[model samples]
Target chain A: MFIQQLINGLTLGSIYALIALGYTMVYGVLLMINFAHSEIFMIGAYIGLWALTAIPAFASFTITGFIITFLVVLLFSGLLAVSVEKLAYKPLRQAPRLSPLISAIGVSIVLQNLIMLFVSNQSMPLPEFKTTRYQIFSAEVDTLQIFIFCFSIALMLLLNLFISKTKFGKAMRATAHSHSVSQLMGINSSSMIAMVFFIGGALGGIAGMLNGMYYGSIKYNMGFFPGIKAFTAAVLGGIGNVKGAMLGGFLLGLIETFSAGYISSQNKDVITFCVLILMLVFKPTGILGENVTEKV
Target chain B: MYKLISVLFLGLILIAGCAKQDKNVIKVALAGPLTGDIAAMGQGMKKAIEIAVEEANQSGVLKDKKFQAVIFDDRADPKEAVSVANQIVSDPQIYGIVGHLNSGCSIPASQIYAKYNLVIITPASTNPKLTQQGLKNVFRVCTTDDVQGSAAANYVIDKLKIKNVSIIHDKTPYGQGIAENFKATFENRKDKVLSYDGINTGDKDFKALLTKIKTFKPQLIYFGGVYSEYGLLSKQAKELGLNAVFFSDDGSSSPEYIKIAGSASEGNYVSMIGIPPAKLKKAKAFLDTFASKYPGTDLQPYDTYTYETSKILIDAIVKTNMDKSKIADYLATVKFDGILGITSFDANGDTLNKSISIYKAKNGKFEYCE
Candidate 1:
């Protein structure tokens, strides 16, 4: 039972971690929480759905078709995220932090309504994927679960490599420390910010696709809770720390699952939130988070 | 100066005269979670009322008098519901109301509606407390959770011959109410309910619950909640290798469930009031009209209820003399032949007789079992 919950928690947490990475990355660079990040996730699912359903080449759920559909969704979602940043957030970057936050909210509302207008407000069902099961010790797991877990880990590892072993990653870290200093250090600050959003959006898109595949449906408003939870995960993991987000995601998922099991299931959200609050109150910097001294 | 004086004098007279005429349009307020997690249900309720008014006007109902529907979206929040109720009561044109879907929303909102003498006919609100309060104006077209809960329990035990059962709920009024009802009925029949638990509506992880359910070795599991959780629960249960048959109430009757649960939705049973759209004779025409109007969008479970509620309201209006007070009296006596079945309000304004249907998901489609 514990192992099963851990697997379930890890699967859910990884998705939240993927989404949280976007939120934390953008925040690290721009100092603005991209409220519209959730909408990007929503749009990704819709784009994938449209591709799978409307595009003749991508109609089947074959591995090749799925891969093609995934790439298309990622590309479209990345472009959508970049456009939103350029139109909504870029103009207000120099303004007060609150201004960008408000604009992000506006962008969120706009994207949600726009999606509702284009895709029916109703939930769109995904085409059924073939199911294959494997038994591990006492646990029986399906192919889908294994796929989600492996995919999320692979994506995170790729992200880690891109951040640690790449020039752009160093620029992103420099920007996170101080944007003005990064600008002086010859980093194209605005473009870096845009790149941050692009990467975040791409990951978000993948998460959305995985979510749609896992849940077998997606809706216009499906992003809200997951977005909030991912944000919570990021905050719990130390907002600017990428690895922190992953840890927080899995931890929160486990807490929610077990609480639903032993405690009241209805109190799952309350338990998750309470854990978040406790962590913030005590550890402050999260499990793998760096403890930054506050300048008075 | 002479032109200005005449314009001001005419505006004053027009404002006073228009106010009196505005009172003539009988406004029926329909409040629901029009834009939230359960917005689909709210939208269905609102659309049904609109269709009812259009049909009523065309049929020369209420002696050629046009009835207007005042809509307010509560977003399915209880606090918002109270404020919407207040807004409804302040408008004198609103002689009647048609919603406030969830029981949590309805309980607070209905108190205000009751105090204001507003006749409320909830098309889909099924919490027993909504009508059990003995509020004169409060009524519902669908049966309560008590009836639904018992029916589900009886079916599982007597029909399926399931001995040990695990029950789960979202812990909201609707979820917990139905769960309790099922638990009571199952216990009464000397059947063992292995475990009863509650889960948050928004939380998706249910592997732990499934794990515990697996240990209990129950043949059946009952969930009293909406489709959002139902889909996740079904998928997660299958993933955790729990093979117990899942059963749910009307809340899980939407096509979205199959979408969320995928092939795991197959063979799961859902009991709901009224027949599925595929089985309903009247539903075919509605579907044709809806498909033509909306195009490609499928109808939700409450769509038929909304259509029937609207028909009943308009039928009552047609029987009345265009007087708001008289219409409420007429509604109590109205024998409405609607899309679902013949509906008539008893003395307490509750529907006299209604039937429930059990549907099974087969190959990603909902098939009527009986």
Candidate 2:
């Protein structure tokens, strides 16, 4: 029981970490939380639902087909994030910091309602994927859990490499350090911001697709709770620190799972938040602490 | 300016005077969660009331007056239901209310309606305390959870011969009430209850909870919640290899549950308040009328009850000349013969129709078993 719950927690933690990276990236680059990012995640799940059910090419549940669908969803989600940044957040970039945050919220509500109006407000089932379970010393682990864990870990590693080694990533880090100064040094801060949003949204979309596959269902507002939790994870790791967001996401997922498994399911959420509060009070800088130039 | 003020005052007086004499439209409020996850049930209730009102108006039941339905969305939340009840009471044109699908919502909303002496005829709420509050103006056309829960317990104990069981509830008044009643009855029969747990309504992840339950290795598991949570529980239970028999109450007696649970829903037992519509000969007319009026739409479990509740409220209004208190009095003694059979209210305002039927999920649908 303990081993199975730990596996479940790790799977959930991977999803939260993927989503938290999005929040941390956006905050790192633009210094503003993209509240609508959750809705972007929701849209990706809907797209996955549509593709698997409506499109014949992606109808079957094969590993290759699933990867193709993820890639397609990732691209669309990234572009959608860019558009949201341009339309909602870009205009308010020069205004008060609070204005963009409020605008992001407005964008979130608009996206949620639009999906409700166009798609559906009710929960819709995703096609089931029968997973094979392996028993290891009286504990069971499924193929889907292993896949999610590995996929998310690979993506995080890739993201880490890109930020540390790539030129575009250096420009983004420079932009985060001083937006005006980066522009003076021939870096297009606007494009860098858009790129950060694209990367964040892409990660969120993958997380959304994984979540839908894990749960076997999707709804218009399915992203709300996960979005809030990922935000908590990002904060716990350190708002602008990439590595910290990943660490916090896993820690929060483990805490929620163990508390729910051992203590009580009803109090898991309460305990998760309590841990966040404690972390904020004692280690306000977070586990990894915010980076200066490498905020992205 | 003085002439304008005087003319405006005259216009206001004319409007108030017209309001006093304009009693041709008799309105009743239908409140429920019309826009959320449970909107399927809410929309079905709306359709049932609309059909009842259409039939009543066509028959000229009120002589010169016509029936009108004023609808509000409570989102199945108790707080929203209370505000909806207050809104309905503020409108003097509304003669009565036929609403509030969830027992949690109905219980709170009924208190507000009772304060204003406005009659509320609930079509679906089954918590015993809804009527046990002794609110004279509150009545229901469906049976209570105490009756439904005990009937389910009897079936599990006598028919299935299940000895040890585990129970879970959504923690709302309706879910918790039914769960407690089931536990009480099961324990009275000296059967072992392995465990009892509570889950939040909108939670999707239940692997941890199910993993914990798997340790008990019970014979059956009973869930006291609506389809939204129960369906997920069913799916997750299968994923975790917890092969216990799944049992639930009327809350999971919807097509949505089958859809959400998919193949995992097979062989699960669910109990509903009344007989299945297809099997009940008395429901033929109601079903036919609904089909003819709203093609390609599904009738929720509560639709028949809501339709009956609407008819009873309309009948009471016709019998009492739209006097709210008199309508309440009429409902208490009224013997309504409708889709659910002869329905009348006890002193506590609970329905006399205590029959419940069980169904098993076969293939992809809930087939009537009893």
Candidate 3:
């Protein structure tokens, strides 16, 4: 029973970590929380649902079909974020902090309602994917869970490497550190910001598709809960730090799962937020967050 | 620019004045969730009420007064329902109301209706507390959840002979009330209730909850929620290899449940209030009219009930001469023979013609089982 709950926790944690990375990355660069990030995730799931169902060749689950879905969702969701940044966030970059926050919220509402109005107001069922279970000792784990866990880890690793080893990543890090200094050093700060939004949006989009595939259903407002949870994870791990976001997400997921399994499912949400509050009260800088000074 | 603006404002005022002066029109308000997850059910109710109003107006139930339906979308939220109730009460033209598909909405909304002497006949809301509020103006066409829960328990214990049962409720007044009743009756019969848990209304993930249920190895898993959640619960339970017989209340009896659950819904049982619309012999005319009017829309489980409730309210209004308080008084002793057979309210304003029919899901359709 413990092992099965752990597996469930880990599967949920992976998706959270994926979405948390988007939150962390955007915060890292823009110093702004993209509240609409969740809607972008939702759009990805809808697009993925559309591709899997509308396209006859990809009607059923296949490796190639999923790969195509991943690419399409990744591209569209990333583009959506880029455009949102350009239209809403970019203009507000020079404005007060609250302005961008309100703008982000407005964008979120618009996106949610647009999907609800145009796409579907009903809960849409994802195309069935055959999952094979393997029994390990007394616990059972399915292929889908394993796939979600592995894919998430691989993406996280790739992101870590990209941030550490790549030149664009180095430029992004420098820009996040000191925007004016990086600009003086001849880096295109706006392009770097756009790139950050794209990568984060892409990751969030993929997470959304994975979430839909895992749950077997999607709704317009489906992103709200997971989005809030992922944001909490991002804050718990240190909002501006990538590694912290990943760690915080897994910890939150495991905590939520174990509590639901052993304690009570009804109170699990209460426990999750309680933990977040305790973390904030004691360690506001977060587990991986450094005491960095804010530039005014 | 000022001249044009004043002209537009005057035109709006004129239209409003004309609408208010229409004395022969008696508006019957219909309030329910017209836009959310349970919209299909609400839309069916609206269509049924519309048909009732059309027929009532054409037949000249009142020689000079004509019936008009004022629709309000409460979105199944309790707060929204209260606001809708307030809106209905403020309007003097609205003589009575047929509404509130959810018990959570209806219970709170019914209070405001009673305060203003506005009569309301809920087509669906099954929570017993709704009628138990002792509100003179509140009534329901269908049975309450206490009856529904006991009937479900009896069916499971005597007919299916189920022993180890697990119950999951959506934590709303409707879901939790019915679940508690079921647990009470089932325990009275000495059946072990493995677990009784609550889940939020809009939550999609239940694997963590289901995984916990798997350890108990319950023989029957009964969910007291709407199709949206129940469908996911059944589908996820199947995926987790939990070999328990799935059962739910009327919320899961809709075709949407099968569509969402896919093949996982097969052989699952759902307890429905009254008879299924297609099999309702008394409602043949109502069904025929509904078919011609809505065209391509399926008849929801409560559509016939809404039709009956609407007809009852209309009859009461006509007899009372469009007096709101008189209509409320008239409805208490009123007995109308119509669809669902002899529609009449008890002392508490609950319908006397009440029965729960069971159905099994097969081939993506709910087939009547008993």
Best candidate, TM-score-wise? 3
Estimate, for each residue in A226-248, the C-alpha lDDT of model 3 and write its tens digit.
Answer: 99999999999988999999998
* Position B201, candidate 2: lDDT: 79
How well is each residue in B1-370 modelled by candidate 1, as lDDT tens digits?
Answer: 9999999999999999886567447777788888766677777777767777766676766664578887999987889999999998987777678887788888888889888777788877887878878777777898889889999998998888888999999888988999999999999989898888887676556777788788888898999999888988998788777899999999888887887787789899999886676677876777676667667666777877777776766556556654566766677777777677678877766787667888899987888887
Candidate 3: which pairs clash? none
Model 1 residue B4 distance off true place after TM-score fit, in angstroms: 19
lDDT of all predictions, in order shown?
Answer: 0.81, 0.89, 0.89
- The sequence of per-residue lDDT tens digits that candidate 2 reaches over residues B10-64 is 9999999897557798998899888877888998999999988999999998888
Please report the interface RMSD of model 2 to 1 decimal.
1.1
Give candidate 2 regions above 4 Å deviation: B1-22
> Can you give the DockQ of every candidate in the order shown?
0.48, 0.62, 0.67
Give the runs in model 3 whose Cα sits over 4 Å from its true position: A291-296, B1-6, B9-17
C-alpha lDDT of residue B238 in model 1: 80
Q: Which prediction has more favorable TM-score, 1 or 2?
A: 2
Error of 2 at B345 (Å): 0.7
